[model samples]
Target: MVITEERIEQALRTLAPVMRRTPMVASRALSDSCGHDVWLKCENLQRTGSFKPRGAYLRIAGLSDEQRARGVVAASAGNHAQGVAWSATTLGIASRVYMPIGASLPKIAATRAYGAEVVLEGEYIDESLTAAHVYAEETGAELIHPFDHEDIVTGQATVGVEICDQMPAVGTVLVPLGGGGLLAGVATAIKLRRPEVRVIGVQAAEAAAWPASLDAGAPVKLATMNTMADGIAVAMPGAVPFAQVSELVDEVVTVSEDAISRALLLLLERAKLIVEPAGATAVAALMEHTDLRLDGQVCAVLSGGNVDPLLLTHITTHGLQAAGRYLTVSVNVPDRPGGLSALLELLRDQGASVVDVIHSRVAGELRLGEVQVTVSLETRGPEHQVALRRALVDAGYLAGE
Candidate 1:
């Protein structure tokens, strides 16, 4: 059960044919903002659209002949289900996966396509996990946990080895932490080889459990957790990973939901990388906590990219609003024939792109002859937003945000 340098290398050999050596790309935008050489470990591009396959493959491959015959079962919301399904299919083993009813349709289809019987069970992951455990107990099937086993951690450690091989001089590494499989694995691998390199773990602020767990010297389960980063919203740290993370990880940081959305937006716009919120948490850490002033070459692991398109649209809009790139303003103008026309002219002159407008004359707060107009405008950024509002006020319109 002891994960070491030799075992991690063995994992690389075992995964060579199944997994990819995901690209390590330099990010000019991140580098310029952080004031350091920054690179992105694009595991988002990994098979099954995330790094889950690495651990899933390694764990299932080590099963005994009798165990393989009994098959494997796992519970997950999305990414891990597909990972286990894909890995099991590749190894020619029968696999059954339980997913929460709310799991995205595309993810469910993907898991089924990977040759696993996908069962929709429960409303959340905890319920699915319960069902999976029961199935395992009854059928004598091996239960493949997402991130709580030594074999899983050892498999994930291969990412750290690859990072070191790709960027030999990396001074710091940032990883997204949920149950800590990836963080624990990467930190162990890096620290064992380059003890001087610092490893930081990032988690969604709303779902963070490690800070409290580390303080209590054990895994601590939360009563509730709400975060858009479903991939890293683990309510409790796994016992196996908690042990390694407490010793090998240099620091653990939490990023807000707003920061995660903004980071995802930046990754899409600047780096042209499609990353889920959990994958963007490390980038969010870099965007936030400006006081950290990280030194030397830094690498942030982009954990996964299997985001639902509808969620992507909503988060993109949320990010835009947070960045002040989109604004909604209310104004009262004369209820005349040219009144709305004049307002449109003003917006045109200010170079503001009008996305929506609602004009009403029966508003409760409307004056005797005035009408209320709600305008949704898209601007260049915060500074442009300020200028546009100022222009609205100076132009003799009662503008309010």
Candidate 2:
């Protein structure tokens, strides 16, 4: 049951024809910010738009013809469901998937497109998983777990092999920890090949499982986890992955939602890579640390790219706000219509791009016959924001930051 380098190598060879050998690209921005040689393992570009396909394909491929005929089933929020569905379709096996009702529309559509019967039930992953288990028992379908099985782990190990081949000088590998299939397999392969290399696993601080689980020396379940990184927002750690991670991984860290969002923005703006919140977690950890800076050649695995369009927009907007590139100012002006026009003209003269404006005369505690004006504007950076604020102050109006 042990995952060794040879087993990983074998899986890589078997999966080569079907799966993509995703790129390992250097990041100049990450390098400049972290003061180290940084490379991105772009598993976001893998088949299924996530690394899930590697394990899913390997697990189904190992099944016998009878097992395949009996069909396979799985429970997931998104990525794993798509993985199993796509793998089953390619292997000509009937598959069924149980997913939370709130699962992303694109993922649900993609899973159905891959020829799996999609059952939407439950408020969270555990509920969907419970339904999937009952269905499997009644229908006599082979259950394919997302991260807990041996074949799935072996399949995920291929990533480590590829990383070693692509970046031989790598001393540290940062992995996003979810249910742990990816980390367990990748850690096993890395330790088996180059025991000297350090494997660092990261989790979203809001939905983190490893911190408490590792402390208790067993897998612990969360009552509820709220985080934007839905991909790694696992409520509990897997039994198999916990064992492997405990033994092989050198460190486990947690990053805040703000940190993850900032990292996501950095990837999009600086690295020019589109990554989901889960995918940006590792880089978030590396960026969050003020004391423990990663040295030498470091690789951060971008786990997936399948982020909701709305969430992506929110993340980008939030990033701009966090960076002081977007600002909102409130000022009191005369009730006359020309007052609003004059204020806007002053903003234009100061080189600020207005995004939104609101004028209120009916509400709030204000001087009689005076109107409240709230303006939202976009600036180039902190300097521009400062310039706009100074100009507003010099123009004889009270402005709030």
Candidate 3:
């Protein structure tokens, strides 16, 4: 049950009415920076705020009446849960979703709002999936494997169809790779139609498994997975996507956490698009590896936009730090009141905006009549950061002034 051009076309036809034809947004900034005309395939704006439903809807709609009557069960980190819930409800089928306990609140709420019975279980997607499989077996319900199933991959291939149609002269397409449904589907669809076009899959470097699996010529489980791009943090590759990715994908690459944060910030600032870290992996790949010879015009798929507000704030700050636009400096000052004021005045003269300041005298390292001050300061860029730190040192604030 591998993906085929016909299957993908059928999926596109089936999903057209429910799917929003997300636009190909041109990024002048990225285009100029990368030395190519860059376009963003905004699946982040797709139904359920992701490309999940294209596959979910198609997978569910194909189930027989009896299968549908028994209801459906699924497990996901977040996006796929909402997708399966939305798709099943739209088809008048009862759905139950098992999600990791750490799944974001908004995603859980959205899944429930989509008319699915949401159960919080396990600490990660793999555990939740195990629970979902058990539920399916016990209840005799159909299990909707997020990216592992044939129908799901074929359905996700619709994004490739849209890209092929939208960007007539596209030379390279970069897709965020996780379990590989999107990559497998999109690569197959595009390669089948436009064999000349390059399709690259980008994964979160910390949790990436595809590269090792491809090297071994079989699926390999990661010892540990850690990344902010939770959307693509699969510990192991899916059977279907593994097969598709191995055979069809032109290249598989990785992007760092800092790169992902910077890419997300860039999307928010330049593209005015709110994309989750996982969704921004495609762009991150380009940012981290600028030397890739993407022959002509490039299209990076912004995969999803379901992010927690708290996480967004943290990532934004992290991005700023990674870009050298923010800094946290620790200094020792006199324990007297005027000492802190003098330090503040020095910062003011240096043109650094203080975000936060923590003054403490509790550290064991503190000398007699002295306190430690940790200041979170915002700067312009790398050069400004260097100048500010130099100014702090010159003022003796950094060396116990």
Candidate 4:
């Protein structure tokens, strides 16, 4: 059955005590940037730091007494595993989760903390899910998919219901799509309530399957999916979710890796919020949308906040490079100490902060007595970077043209 309004309402009631309704926080910075009244549905604050718990709780709540006794099994990259583990434990039911080997450490640890048996299996979420399905069939444990099921979609639709209640003025909803469960549910709710409001789905360009799936009107698996937004890195949309997304979703947009990193940096630095790459994908769409028509009261669902600390660090550095604040320059100077000192003095005068200095006496086509010195500097922008290079050149150091 399709996700109905009544089903979503019941799911909300079932999950009321277990799930956080989360906040709809206004972002002046985002609004000013996009020229829209932007509000973030911070599902990153939901139980398990993701909206996955809503669906998982509702799915577990649907299990019969017999199924509950047999326990439940699920597979996910990270967020969905934690969601299922937490929900099963809350209901006093035993749970087992199979996760990809590449799943984040924080997610695996969180799943373990929720009183579930964690199984690290396979290379990607699909493989893990396949293993879980086999285990469930062999052991008779109930299978709770991260998406694809009606109960899960209905549970995810609760977000749409809460958004309507919290912000009746919301005219558009932007959501990140992996298997499309969240988007399907939200689309059903908004379409049923106010068919006028639009539902837009954002996917990582590097790992986009929905675009082709929607065009073909079927779920097509990808041979590979390479994206930093691991949360939405599904190789193919689910059968059930594909139907709903193809039918209800108004548009499916893709965001580049660079755009996602930039959005994550913006959310962290300017909004003071920690959003994973997948969670920030919707905001990335808002920033990079070629069409200027989506500028009204827009709500972007931040689906999860489970980024690894290492990934966050990389995203920050990459964002700096993307924004032109960081630059690398190669300078040819005499292989002497004082020669490097003179170049440093000019850089100091140019107001550029030196992040790293690598001097090599024997590499990259250097002259007999001259060494190649690469200076990585932090500058304000193109202008500051230009001035820094100019100052270095005016002093007779051969900075790369």
Candidate 5:
């Protein structure tokens, strides 16, 4: 059955007690940048740190007693695994979750903590999905497709319902696209209720499937998918969600990895929200898409917050460098100990905070008595970085980028 507005409403009411009504707050930074009122739908704070549980609960609840007894199996990168494990645990049903071997450790632990048998299989989500299907067939367990089913779409539509109720003047809504489940559900609800509201979908440039699929006029599978935004890195769009998105979504755009990192850093610093790369795609699109003529209130859905700590650290460092807040330069100096101390003094006088200093005596590029010293500094911005570099150069030091 196709997911309709009426079905979405019913699903929202049914899942209300089980799900959190995540906040939709105004984003002054985004609004100022885009020259329009921008709101953030913080589903990153939803139960299980994503919107997956809503669909998982509803899908599991719809199963018959026999089906429940037979148990359920699902494949996911992380979020959906936790969602299904949590739902199955709550319903007193057996569940087994297959996840990519490289999935986040915290997510794997959380899924297991929710009382589901965790199976680490394959290198990508599609491989894990294949394992889940095989296990389902061998054990007669119910297979829960992540984003393809009408019930799952109906459950995800609740996010759209809440967005409409929270921001009545919303002129545009941006959602991160994976297999297109969330976008399909949100678009169906918003467009059906407020036909004038424009719904746009955002995808990571590296793993985007929607643009090519839309161009082909059908669901097309990508040969390979690689992206740091693993949460929304589906190699292909789901058939059901593809149909819904094709009919309802107004536009689709892709954002680069640098844009995604910047968006995550922006959200964490300005909004005080820790969002995953996939969750920040909408915000990234808003920052990158200068052609959008948004006038009235616009909402960007922050879809999930299940990022690994190591990845967060790397992204934060990259963002700092990209913003010119961090600067690194190599300089030729005297081989004596006082030479290093003199350079540090100069940096301190220049108001540059030294993060790290590396001294090398190698003769690759240095003169007979010269040594190469690499300095990492934290500066205010690009201007400060330029000023510091000029000061170093004026001091008779050969500085390199």
Candidate 6:
């Protein structure tokens, strides 16, 4: 079924009082970097910490009384699970949500807290989806697919409607593509209202299926998917959303894992926003792709913020490395107590904050009289890292990789 602007407007009316009309805030940092008037669609701050609730609520609300009585079931890595759980609870419908075994702990906890029975199964979203389908068939529960149905797409299109209404001069819109629901819905809505606006979809390079599927003229499945952005790590594109995307979306692009990490860090540090890796893909694409003609008002949707704290630390470290703000260096010094101390002094003089220090004398590369002192330091940026390394080498110390 085709999702129309009218249906999106209807969904907006239904969700207006309940859903948060997430802000579209100007991002001066991104604007300067991308050479465009950049704005952030902060759906990360939406209820349930993602845009999933918009569709999930609409899907559950449209169910018949008998269907609602039988309950609802869904499968997601994290965001959608919380969305379905929260929506079902609000509508007084019982919910069972299947999530991957390695799904974020906080998301799983939040889903259960939303009054849904949470089932941990499989290693990825597809496997969890399989288990959900089995449960739905056995219990006669209404299965709410995360991004494939017309109701879900129509619901998500409300984001585009808001963008058009909020930022009338917006010339380009970048949305992260997972199973393509957000991209399909947003593109359809925006194009229907303002056909001149360019709609672009961004995907994680590691788990991207849309590019291949678009090339093949059908939904294509990946053999394996691996990425830090577990939220957008769908192995296959949904047929329903794919059709909408193929028709409405102007372009689809991919961003590297490092790019995503850097984008997340940028949002955290510069924008003072905690954004998940998947949600940062649109920004990542804009940052990495200098060829994009984003001269006019451009908006990148920050789709979700349901990141686990532990994972956030790892991603932050990765981002620091990607940005050249963190450095690890090893220097050979005399095998003495003061040897490591001397190197630490040098690092301090170089304006590098030492995070970790390790001293070893039994290394194969080190001589009998020499100890290897490895220091992990945090620096200002690439120039500071370069200066620190140069100073270490000029100090007559063997600074090896």
Candidate topping lDDT: 1
Q: How accurate locally is residue 45 in candidate 6, as Cα lDDT from 0 to 100?
A: 96
User: Each prediction's TM-score against the native?
Assistant: 0.97, 0.94, 0.97, 0.96, 0.96, 0.97
- What are the per-residue Cα lDDT tens digits for candidate 4 across 337-374? 69888888888888889999998987878779998889
- Lowest-scoring 10 consecutive residues by lDDT in candidate 3? 392-401
lDDT: which is higher, 1 or 2?
A: 1
| Candidate models: Cα lDDT each | 0.93, 0.89, 0.92, 0.88, 0.91, 0.91
Candidate 1 deviant stretches above 4 angstroms? 399-401
Once fitted onto the true fold, the runs of candidate 4 whose alpha carbons sit more than 4 angstroms away are 290-292, 386-401
Q: Which residues of candidate 6, in runs, are more than 4 Å off?
A: 399-401
Task: Write candidate 2's Cα lDDT for 53-108 as tens digits.
Answer: 99999999988888888999999888899899999999899999999999989889
lDDT score of residue 133 within candidate 6 = 95
Residue lDDT tens for model 1, 1-401: 26987889889999999899999999999899889999999999999999999999999999999999999999999899999999999999999999999999989999999999999999989999999999999999999999999999999999999999999999999999999999999999998889999899999999999999999999999889999999998989998999899988889999999999999999999999999989999999999978764657999999999999999999999999988889998889999899999999999999999999999888878889899999999989999988888898898885555
Error of 3 at 105 (Å): 1.4
Per-residue lDDT of candidate 3, residues 222-249 (tens digit): 9998899999999889998889889888
Residue-level lDDT of model 5, residues 41-136, one tens digit each, is 999999889999988899999999999999999999899999999999999999999999988899999999998999999988888999999999
CA-RMSD of model 2: 2.0
Error of 3 at 5 (Å): 2.0
Candidate 1 — worst ten consecutive residues by lDDT sum? 287-296
Per-prediction backbone clash count = 0, 0, 0, 0, 0, 0
